[model samples]
Target: MDFFTAQEQARRQTGRLVVLLVLAVLALIAVTTLVVAVVLYMAGIGGAHSQPQPTLQGMMALLSWELLASVAVGVVALVGLGGLFKRRQLRRGGKAVAEALGGREINLNTRDSDERRILNVVEEMAIASGTPVPSVYVLEEEGINAFAAGYQPGDAVIGMTRGAIRQLSRDELQGVVAHEFSHILHGDMRLNIRLVSLLHGILLIGLAGGMLLRSLRFRRMGGNKRDNSAALVMGLGAALMLIGYAGTFFGNLMKSAVSRQREYLADAAAVQYTRNPQGIGGALVKIGANAKGSALAAPQTAEFSHLLFSQGIKQGFSRFMATHPPLKTRIQRVMPGWDGQFVALKPAPGVTVEPDQSPQSTAGAGGRASVRDNVRASLENAGAPHAGSMATVLSAASVQMAIGAMGQPDQRHVAQAQTVLSALPAALKTAAHEPYTARALIYAMLLSENDAQRQHQLAVLENIALPDVFTELHTLMADVARLDVQLRLPLIELTLPALTSLTIEQAQHFRLCMERLIHSDGHVSLFEWTLYQLLLSHLSEHHGGAENLTLQACERECQRLLSVLAAAGLEQGLESVQERASEMAHALHAAQQVLPFELAAVEDADDMQALSLAVERLRRLKPLQKSLLLQSMARCIEHDGRIRPAEAELFRAIADMLGCPVPPLLGGGTEEQAVLAE
Candidate 1:
């Protein structure tokens, strides 16, 4: 299934989960009400003059509507309150989840080779997939396990056990990381968080029963008067415990049904992402061969068993309760020809691993020939351009491929990402890994092309930024100016982990400095606006909940986005105003053809502030609705014969806002590159 279909399926699964939760709650209420009725009847509290009979009819008579209603209300309130409390506690997103699991966030500047290798793998995947690079956490455990957790990509984190990093090879580590990325892309993280919250409520019933039983230990039953009351309390507590545990038993069954299939899907996705079945298959084999296996040492493993890469806890007495498929089964699915033998893992001695270099050719020469034919076909379908417009044909194909690769980047994208990362300067890469210089690197990117405006922004930064950071900005300014325009976003992505390391006060100050620098020249270029929005979306304190917007609800926002994109596509060097207007009209017409309704041109079509507002509103579009809107935007960009750097950047920014990860359109030098080179 494609990313959108997977996301829709996840939503359906969540609905099913809610239904199961309701059934379980109803069962708990019924059981609790019966227990309460029995307690009252035995204690002779049903009525003062009532003659208690030892019969089923007497029990039925005692279960009055008033009594049943009161018990049901109490049970519902307890479960509801417990769920709300857990959700509130986890409001900080995946970081909170990680911290609760005894994970320590890995520093971006860590010197440990194992930590560095995992960090590199994660960065490559993030760039290839066009999502924000997630925060990495390390659990000091010897088990080969990992998990991805968060409500959305913006606040997501990837956690790994020490053994997983130390024992797995680079390819194996990449496989595991890709498996987690699938969870993020397929909307599994949000569903997993919801499971954690809802299950906590069901577990609360058992906890309440246990607490009641323990409290009865200190009470003294002096005479027969107190003996009846003691016996009644003991019976009620025992019944509550039985019912609560029964509810828990059903909840685990529900979790197992929901989680097992997704594990298989994630394994397949990992192989698809790396085009290396052996990578993931080998990891599974090692897990089986190792004595510890993938079992976690953490006490909270049972709570997050479904989130782990492998089963982190043992299934007691029943395969039906296992959240993951058996190890051999998972291995065979990834590698169908597996001999069903587990490979024993040994510690690597004096081994140093480096990031894989980009291949000289991607896939093979046949792939390039196929791409050419596809581009030619696209040009013909869109009405042939002039003979010298090969660049236009190539750009068209890139945009189409980008749309196709959303949330499912293949090996080609990974190689392209490696090439980009390799092209970055060593010094700048180092700066991107440290918080102090990372801020300066971002500020340097925002400096204006005009010498006076650049100096003005520098002046603003010098006053508000840390003295050391301002100095670092001056030192990096020359290199930043010379950097390729296409590399700008990837560079910003690299800084995310380091930036996240800053204290709250420090982050706030950094954001303030960025705003001053962007508006220092009285204008926000498209690049500046895109950079600002990307940073703001990822770094913000609050992560927005799931959205269910339809196309009709976001009609105005859709038009605004298309209008801005259509205007962005017009070549600035067009010989005449009429030529520019003609291009804009063509772009708009192309958009209208894809859209269900007519799109009217707005007067301030290129207004950054207005575009920002439109983007915020459109971010709430449903996954399928977003797919349609993106196709319209792509149509507008392709209407023009050629794709400019500015236009590609704007398109990427919009896609990022809509939660679609489009790989970088890597090719050809731009005018900005030429100017920077000079």
Candidate 2:
């Protein structure tokens, strides 16, 4: 599955959801219209039927247009408002989902072995998958379930039940994490959120009806009973209760169909991702035998049942309403030719299943090796530019390879990720593991090299920095300053989860401090601006910058983005400016072959302001459009046959802004070598 194509498909699913929702609303309108007509007849607002009984046709004809219209309007408004209100509540994205489910985030510095192991699995998977590591949450429930939730990669969170953490082996845990990551990569999360919100809106009617019925019963018991008006109210409440449940029945059918298909896809993807069916297959077997049986006990589980890894509630008598496919069917899909028998696992106390032979550990093996060896090999493969070598451009193919690796790492990329992690300075790595030190570390990264500018940056930090933050800053500044430019962005990526642990007020203040530092020098360096914007964009709890953008509507912004990139290539090249301009024109022409795009003029070649605006607009582009844009930017930058660290940083910054987390280009291989490595 191509990442861009998968995202496009997800967008189409949202459209399908809209069509389905409209049908559901119409159904509600029809049901409510009939119910209201009956209510009126019972209330004697229509002519009293004292003398003659009306036929079924007469009853249909007696439905007043005025009353029907009122009920239709009322149902539409109620359903629409309920859905919109729920969606609004969820605008905070993955965090909201996690909180709603009572998930407690596991701190990166956690001491518990199981929690730490889960974190390791998640981090490695994140690195291998080329996405920023998501924040991890633990549901206190003992059910063996997990889920990935978020609208976009930046704010995504991973939630696992305590049962999953304790009961599964490392490989089994890996399989579960990989399965959740597939959901993230395949674009199911946003759709899942929409389904939950829409179903809630539909379910609200039934709840309201029940409330009305209960109130009527209470009234009857208290005083007013035998009168016609009281009888009418009782009849109306009972009718609404019935209609409300009818709506719920249909809504669950829709939810079940959608949820079940995605579960199969996720299971298959997990097997492909790990290249190990037994890992995930073993997890299923365990769930089958375990007493807990992956059934969640949380009050909110019913609402989020479709999002969990396994059936969170009873499947009920009807299979059509089950959120997940049966265990046997799912297992067969991952492991064909299996006999229809399940062996329930019962590991000895304090023991977990270990594979007969780990696929990643063998010499000459094409799959996973021992974690320590993988780490060591990756460190050995890490490369640096030769001193005084000024080649700063890469070939077109190299550019394509780099962008292609974004959010879709192969074995080679996974190896390089290990190297990137290994390459981190020990001090910096420590700081990234804690919120306060992580804040100090970022401040240190943004501190200017020049003495006067550095002092001014320090002044900005002094106002907001806790005493401990300043002490940590003083301790870590020199090492961060001496760090390689290629390592800077990765370090920032590493610290994101820890930084996310901050309270909203602290995060806001952190943003303020970052902005102050960037503007303190009276000139925003490209690196400074990029780092500040990227940090604020991801860290702000309420930032929804890309929510409204569409590729079809943002054509000019696309052109502006490519033009800025083309112009940057032109200015930064060692060749004559005109010659570089010609090279960029060729690159832009190549981009047109892949996407419907064109460059307007080279006059804006050095337009820094245009570049910033372009970044903002392009952030809203759909996943496929973003892929094309990233490829286009790479083509333009690599036109001169050299790619400077600064240009590479800018390229990565733009991709990250669009919610595509890119690892260090070719694992920090030198320009010519990295191109060859690609």
Q: Which prediction has the highest TM-score against the true structure?
A: 1
Q: Which candidate is the best by lDDT?
A: 1
C-alpha lDDT of all candidate models, in order? 0.79, 0.72
lDDT of 1 by residue, 181-231 (tens): 999999888899889899888888887878778878888866666356776
**In model 1, what are the clashing residue pairs, if there are any?**
none
Summarize candidate 2's per-residue lDDT along 1-678 as a digit string, tens digits: 667777778778878987888898788878777876666665555773522564566456557778778877877777778888888888877878888889999978776767777776777677666576789999998778888888777778999998888888766877788788878877888789888888777777777777776776556453543356656667777776677778778888888888899888788777665556777877887788778889987888888888889998998889998989998888888878667676766541333212111123132223334543445344444353331112223344545676665545544554445455555676787688799899999999889888988997887788877889888999999888778666677678778899877888888878887878877867766677678777766776534444346666777776766666665555543478578657667767755555664665446544556666767777777777777667767766776566767677677777777766665565334442332232
Per-prediction TM-score, please?
0.90, 0.87
Model 2 residue 245 CA deviation (Å) reads 2.2
Q: After aligning candidate 2 to the native by TM-score, how far in Å is the CA of 366 from where it should be?
A: 10
Supply the global lDDT for candidate 1: 0.79
Model 2: how far is 451 from its true place, Å?
A: 3.5
